[model samples]
Target: MCPLFSPPLFMQRYQFVVDFVQAHGSKKVLDLGCAECSLLKQLQYHGKGVELLVGVDKDSSSMKTRMHSFAPLSSDYLQPREGPLEIELYQGNVTQPDPITRGFDLITCIELIEHMQLEDVERFSEVLFGFMAPSAVIVSTPNADYNPLLPGLVGFRHPDHKFEWSRQEFQLWAVRLSELFGYSVSITGVGALDDAHTDVGFCSQIAVFNRKPSQNDPTNQHRSRGEPTVYRLLYSVAYPSLSDNNVLQRMLVNEVLSQAEQVKAAWLSGEWAAKMAGAREPYRQGGDICVSLLDVWACPQVKHLCGTLRRFTEALVGERRVPLTPDRQAVIVPTEEEDEEELDEEEEDEEEMAAVEARCTTTTTSVATEDWEEEITHSAVGELTACHVLAHD
Candidate 1:
């Protein structure tokens, strides 16, 4: 368990979203489904340059509890009588047009989309992209393919979650939404990886979308309809920024070191060696073991360790004189004595399998080869530990 100032995997995701939001220099921020206003509270503690923070949720009772708790706190930045926090609480459904005014710089909906029915996601997107028209939007949800990584986990992560999407599924949806909304998207993950299933890695995934400036221009087709008065403001208060502690910084260092150790252990255990031997059948049948292993190794969190493991695997394969089929040219050709019909059938099957494998290989290799600074900077670490927050503010 992580300390109050250092959140675990699930909470860490909120930090990532907040970091992205802060990096964009957003002032007016709105969080959809802001249950307990926990995310807003976190921002108050760690965030910089945020001027206005608005939180909306369907549960009015939770909003009341959060508002009441923060109302009494006083500081140089926040006065109890004057209410200096610049925070607003609203009870409203996120599926509809946001009740707040237009031109919000950043909007976030974390772990909320999966609760909606599959068919309703489109409408939710329309409201978010078309009606809200924020400069940036950050969304996150559970990664279904990653469920196997969780110990004793069964079914969805939450009972209310309508569906958990696989990486491909989430990517497809993000791509479609980006096209429809004129936004560019980047996908990343949050969570620890188990050795048993490192391919999919993270338990949760996030998609950050930056709406094109041109799309917000007057001539654009999808213009915001201004603000609507749909939500009742529960209260407004001032929340002071909390001082930072070295605890979070230390915890992140420990986490990175722990992950590096895990990668080393996996490699030293001869797991990759065994996987390399298994590659023979797959490679001959037009599949790629390297590509599959690369998916697990490409994560930024363990890139250095992964590099060592990758080199070790390649070295081991070389020493064993193992053949690696990189493409069709490397595949063994059928002999002239072989039956024509049987050869034709085999070729057809191999071609189809090769096509699919080629796509996977291309993507995995690109991620593996992308240039990233070997040294981790403070900003980078801050991004990595985005969920860490003070217990109170």
Candidate 2:
């Protein structure tokens, strides 16, 4: 492990797989030899476009003990989902031919093959490339050549590793498999050392295998096969999605009320008043206070909310005064005027604030005042605030 990399070597290996899936838009992914489901935990959140993620490990007890690590959390509901994501964990051997996991977009066997007996390696390749042929596969293992570089280390990096392959040996094995399975293989590595021993290569060597597109491609041939699942399903979960009406309704209500309360707090704060002191128009028009749509988008409290979800919040602000102008840039919030009957409306507003405080416990942020001040100074506060308002129409 190098001092420069904070996450160290093992995490870098996982990150490489994540970056690959994100780049290629792999919708279905399988992780072989998943210990404690660490890669699954990372892939669930960071693996973009990953709709179906499956993990298999021979160590059933390890995967079972950490099943909760990949489950959806309380905060997952606050944000909208990219799409439907389903994760499943199973206990099984990698060399077995499992019908359920076949024809995936991508498969990863990270730092796993070195632990297998020499004879099982051939069976593992036959299962992955011939039977369960995915479009792409990534495999990483220790580089025996780099073992001597470590000051106190001797022999293999891990005691459990049956055999460690030198760079040439790993590439020879990979090239032979690529030829036999009709796939293309490329070699890369991680945990690079300084210039002095660059020739020795990375501590961890990797082989990326992509099935060659052809009439005889194994993946195409096996895409429709219906083999029974060999792995035992230990756990499964589907995350909440905006497509669900109840979920969307709850999220929409919480954000609208939270934003409304935030706007109100900003209007009352002395910093907001000081920022608006030089505006050309009065802060309030009749009974409505002006708010910037841009500022609302930038507010740290709701900053994590996506632009599309914000549109829903913008649309569902019923009965309040948050009507967008023709340009769809600005809005307004209605307040109480000096009329005697308006006292009732003011009391209602106070009660509404109290309710907002109770339902939304997220701390309000005042640090964005300077951002508003900078943008407001460039144009009149009235014009900017008029562009976007968070209120019920």
CA deviation > 4 Å runs, candidate 2 = 1-7, 216-228, 243-246, 249-393
lDDT of 2 by residue, 225-279 (tens): 2323677777777776666555555554455445654665676674443222332
Worst 10 residues of 1 by lDDT: 362-371
Expressed as tens digits, the lDDT of each residue in 180-223 for candidate 1 is 88899998877644465668856668898988778335223332
Best by the TM-score measure? 2
- Per-model TM against the reference: 0.55, 0.65
Q: State model 1's lDDT.
A: 0.57
Error of 1 at 375 (Å): 30
Q: After superposition, how far is residue 280 of candidate 2 from its true place, in Å?
A: 24
- How far is each candidate from the true structure, as Cα RMSD in Å? 26.6, 16.9
